[model samples]
Target chain A: MITITGLSKSFQTPYGKVDALKNINLEIKQGDIFGVIGFSGAGKSTLIRCLNRLEEPDSGIIRIGEHEITSLNKSQLREVRKRIGMIFQHFNLFDSKTVFGNVAFPLEVAGLSKRQIKNRVEQLLELVELTDKTNAYPAQLSGGQKQRVGIARALANNPEVLLSDEATSALDPKTTYAILELLRNINRKLNLTIVLITHEMDVLRRICNNVAVIEDGEITEMGPVQELFLNPRTDTTRLFVQSDQDLQLNNYSI
Target chain B: MADDLLPLLIVALSETVYMVLLSTIMALALGLPLGITLVVTSKGHISEFSGLNNVLGTVVNIFRSFPFIILIVVLLPLSRFLVGTTLGSTAAVVPLAIGSAPFLARIIENSLKEVDKGKIEAALAMGAKSITTIWKVLIPEALPSLVRGITLAVITITGFTATAGAIGAGGLGSLAIRFGYMRYRDDVLFATVIVLVIMVQLVQWGGNFIAHRLESKHHIGM
Candidate 1:
């Protein structure tokens, strides 16, 4: 389980200090696929990044499975980070590395023996179903394949929580559906808690059990995915639901 | 006359190769760490020590701005101190290396900076130490660019060797000036120029080959 309290972060731009995240609070239960939905600049990215302390919160207490993440020193933070895997929208698999190498990277960092790394990486490739593309570089793979590699790499450490920062935003709809299915399968198989942030309500509808609606820098609505989709409270949540429905209608017409 | 010129040309070509190779090694040795330091210390980087970044930047700029001809003259004493002489191909290496180190550092800095920020963040997210990220991620990703930059540095240093040769550093350049131009032997000068050009072309071709081989083949529509 992960708990965040009074989380706030701001950036100093030339224009002046701009608050990217307000005093936010959230609790993501274990084995739950929690999704945060917001438009661009809604601070969802900042909120997800802050969970890993990727963007350090100005003031907050973040506790992940008994570890007080906000209080840990640099080395301690790294140890904590190992248990919290994060994936990016761009599928940040190392371009210079083959799929095998990319998946083996975290194991190498964790100081696993070469034999252990090989076995584990092979297992991960099997999990991601990219066994045949093991020798191919990231550039050779399609977007879906690259994201699979990213997922495999993220899971290498057997992280308790997987953070997906708009992981499917770059994929086409079909690929997005496929990737979401993969994530849902991984969540069930590993019972790993997943915290994903996206602007797409279809993503929430597809995989997420719980959803939060963030507008500007604040959460305006929070509930189960179905409840929120059926009865959106705030204007931002309504806007997102309306748009998602419009997209579906347009797709059906096409 | 042809026999005499052949031996002289052979010796000169060997000298140029010796000086260029050694100095290039020296430049890489000194400049690579300096370049990494520059990038890692800059704003919002892994280390992000602005003070060190500013000081190092100023120092590199100071060295980079010096005219190569004057730089050699200025470093004559240091070269003599380090190599026990300021003449010949071996002694020329000290000044040559110093002259090119800052230039290579800038090239390396640019190459390293071009590495995707997202990649570094991914490495960090995976619990990689900064050193690990630098060695395993940044270096590997930027390798092709780094090779190209080093090739440019080598080619630039090769040109500087001619200027160094004018000051008693024995090489094709010195031979061209001393035995070829001074003696009005257009044939010797022409031969040296041809050798120099071929050497440069070979370096360029080799650099490109290695870089191309190292590059990951990207499929269309990425």
Candidate 2:
């Protein structure tokens, strides 16, 4: 569960100031598969980074299950990070590490013993169905396999909230569907709260329970995924849902 | 003529080999980190310490811009402190390492900068520290470039070592200077130049082969 109030971020450039995010407020409930959809530079990435305090907001109150993570110092924030995992679009497995090592790095950082870490990494690999590829380097894996390793590594600490920043954008459609399915299974199995950041509405339709539309650093629409489709308010949301020409012509139902 | 020339040539060859080998090792050991540091301390890279980058770049350029002949003179004291004398095979390596480390660093930094930032961002997203991302994603992905950078630096250092021999450091260059430049022995000079050229060619060929091996591995993986 996470809550944000009056968040704004402005960056200084040589010419003038640039506003990346402007006055955003939202609340994410426990066990919710929330998708934030926006075009490039809609500030979706920055917004999600703020949730885990990876990127600091100039003014905002971020409450991660009542801890107010925005106020924590570096060590305290790092502790909080252990409970909130993140995956990337490029499946950022450590190129230098074996798949097993990549998945176990978090466990190692958490100071687990060799036995405990091996056991946990093995369990994680099994969850992502990457057991056979344990010794393979990230460079050796296909795009889909790389993503599986990323997911396994994210789940290493048994994080309650998993943030996915365009995690499937770089993959093929088949791989995308499989990764989404994996996320759904993880959500059901662990009751984990997942926050997916993407620019694709099709992705929201596939896995998100709750969907939010962001435009020019503002949240224009947000509600139950099914409901948002039926009562799409913004031009952005309509374009997102009806992205396929045939879908727009057919008038999609919830 | 053959018997008289054999021992001297053999000794000269040994001296040249020692100079090249020691200087290359020193250059690699000291240069790789300097390059990594240049990348890390750059804006928006691993460490993102721009002030450090500026200071380091300035220092590197200052040393690099000075002529090699000047560098040997300037570093004479440092060479003595390091090797207790600045006129032998061992003594010359100090100048070679110091002179080329920064040049190699620049090459390394440029090479590392060519690695995909997308990969690095992904590592960071997974909660990796700055060091992990650097050593893991950045360095490995940049390996091919690093090999090329190292090759360039090594060749550059070889040239510097030969130039350093003018200050009395022993190598084929020193032998050539002694017999050919000072004593006016055209035969010794001709042979020395030919050997140095061949040695450089071999190094270049070896470096290119290794760089290709690394590049192909990366290509196959991707």
Candidate 3:
């Protein structure tokens, strides 16, 4: 479970101060698939990055379970991070590592025994259906396969929370669906809390049970996914739902 | 071409090899950490010590700006102080390594910069410490470029060894000056040049081969 309150971040550009994230408040329950939807420059990335304290907030209180994440020191933050796994839009697997090595990296950093690491990595590779590609480098894998490896690597430390930053945006439609399905399966199987952000409405609709619509660094709407889809409160959310409908009608016309 | 000259050529070539190889090893030892520090301490980087980064950067640049000939003169005291002499192939190693360490550092910094920032963030998110991220992700990702850059540095150091011969370092360049220029035997000069070219070529070839093999393994092409 994660709780965020009064978070604000700003960046100084040549022109002036740019408020990337306004005073924001959010909550994600355990075992819930939460999606944060926003267009480019809407501070979606900053919001998610702030959860892991990758992007230091100018002011905020972030609580993950009982620990106040915003107040943790360097070593304490690292300890907190062990419970939170993050994936990138680019599938940032270590290019120099084999699939097994990439998945096992977190375990090694956690100082697991060699035998434990081998067993855990093999189990992860099997879960991602990448057993055959265990020895392959990231460069050699397809985009879908690469994302699978990324997913496997994220799950290496048995994290309670997985933060996905546009994790499926780089893939094709079929691959996107497959990755979303994988995320859903992982959520159910491990009871993991997933907080994913994307600009695509389809990405939110496919898997997210609870969704927050963000615009210009503020949360415009937040509720159950189906309720928001049926009755969007803000123009941004309405446009997203309308567009999804337009896309469905266009497919029918074709 | 005579028997006496054959032995002389062999000794000079070996001396040159010794100077260049030792200096390169020394330079690498000093420069690798300097390079990593430059990148790590940079603004917005993992370490993010801009003050330290700027000061160290300026120092590396100052060392790099000096001409190798001037560097040799400037380092004369240090060379003597370090190795108990300032006039032989052994002593020349000090100036040569000091002269090229900054150059190697800059090349290494550039290669480290080429690694994707995403990789670093991913590492951090996975609870990896800064040193671990640098060693596991940053250095390994930049290794091929670093290898090629060091090859260039090695070749450049080889040239510097010959220049150092002007100061009694007893390499092929010294033999060229003593035998070819002083004694008017152009053959010795030509032979030295040919040998230097051959040595550089061999090093370049080897560097490229190793870099390609590493690139094939590590480059993600994404």
Candidate 4:
């Protein structure tokens, strides 16, 4: 379980200090797929980044299980980071390394021996269904394939929590669905807690058990996915629900 | 006559080879870490050690701006101290290395800086420390650029070595300068230029081939 309280993040701009997240309080149950939805610069990314301490909060407490995030030192942060794996919008696979090597990287950093790394990499590659592309570089893979590799890499070290920052934003709609299916499968199979941030509500609709709407760095609404969709409190939430409503209403041809 | 010319050309080529290889090795040894330092100390890098970055930046600029010939002469005392002599090919190795080291450092710094910040962030988010991130991610990601930079440095140092030859360092450059320029032997100068061009082409071609081969081309579905 993850609990975040009074989470706020601000970055200095030429104009002044710009707030990315403000007083973001949330609780994600174990094995829950929680989604943070927002428009551009809405603090969705920042709020999610706080989960892994990727973007440090100005003031707040983030607890993953019993451990508090703000209290971790450099070494302690790494320990926390290892448990909270993340995937990116661009997939961010290492270009120089093969798919297998990319997956093995975290294991190697954790001081796993060559044999251990090899076996783990093999298992990861098989899981991602990229066993054949184990020797291929990131450039050789398609967009969907790249995200799969990202998933395999994220799953390395058996992280209990996975933070996906717009993991499907770079892909086409079709590819996005495929990747989402893969993520859902991983979550179900591994019972991993997932905190996904995206501007697209469909991403949340697809796999998230719980959803949160963020605006100007604060959580404006939060609840179960279907519940939030049925009753949206904020204008942003209304917009998302309305869009999905339009799509659904259009399809029914009533 | 052709036989005599072959022996001389071959021996001269050998010296050019020696100087380029020797100085390039030294450049890499000193420059790679210096380059890594420049990246880490920059504004957005892991450490962002502004003060240390400034010191490194100033040191790099100082060496970079120093004219190699004058720097050679200025370094004469130090060279004399290190090698017990400050004249000839061996002495020339010292300055040649020093001259090229900064060039390489700057090149490496530029290459490493271009390694997408996201990759480094991804590694860091994985609980890897700065050193581990560098080893497992930064260095590997910048491998192609680093290789290209080293190749350019090698070729540039080849030119620098020829100039240093004027110092009696004794190489094809020295030979070209002594017999070709100073002695007014146009044949030897023409020959040196031709050899240098061929050597550069070879290095450029080889470096490019390796960089391309090292790159991962995106084929998403495959």
lDDT of 2 by residue, A106-167 (tens): 88767789999999998999999989988887778889998999899889899889999999
Give the clashing residue pairs of candidate 2, or none. Answer: none
Candidate 2 ranges beyond 4 A from true positions: A248-254, B181-186, B208-222
Q: After superposition, how far is residue B215 of candidate 4 from its true place, in Å?
A: 2.7
Per-residue error (Å), model 1, residue A139: 1.2
Tell me how each candidate scores on DockQ against the true complex.
0.61, 0.37, 0.67, 0.57
Docking class of 1: medium
Please provide, for model 1 over A1-254, each residue's C-alpha lDDT reduced to its tens digit, 9 standing for 90 to 100: 98999999999999999999999999999999999999999999999999888898999899989899899999999988988988899998787888999999999999999999999999999999999999898888899999999999999999999999999999999999999999999999999999999988999999999988998899889989999989989898889889989999999999
Candidate ordering by DockQ (highest first): 3, 1, 4, 2
Winner of 2 and 4 under lDDT? 4
List the RMSD of every prediction in angstroms: 1.3, 3.0, 1.2, 2.2
Give lDDT tens digits, candidate 4, residues B1-222. Answer: 324445666777887788788878888899988889999889878878899889988888999899889989988987798778987766777888888888899999999999899999899988989998888789988888888999889889988888887886777888788778887877777877888789999999999988776663432334
Instruction: Encode model 4's per-residue lDDT on A1-254: one tens digit a residue.
Output: 99988888899999999998888789999999999998899988888778887777899999997789888898989988888889999888888788888899899888899999999999988888989888888877889999999999999999989999999999999999999999899899999999999988789899999988888888889899999888888898999889987987887996
Model 4 lDDT at residue A117: 93
What's the candidate order when arranged by decreasing TM-score? 3, 1, 4, 2
TM-score of each: 0.98, 0.90, 0.98, 0.95
Candidate with better lDDT, 3 vs 4: 3
Candidate 3 to truth, TM:
0.98
Q: How do the residues B1-222 of candidate 3 rate in per-residue lDDT, one tens digit apiece?
A: 766677888999999999999999999999999999999998778889989999999999899889999999999999889999999999999999999999999999999998888998899998999999999989998889999999999999998998899888889989998898899988888888898889999999999999999988866465
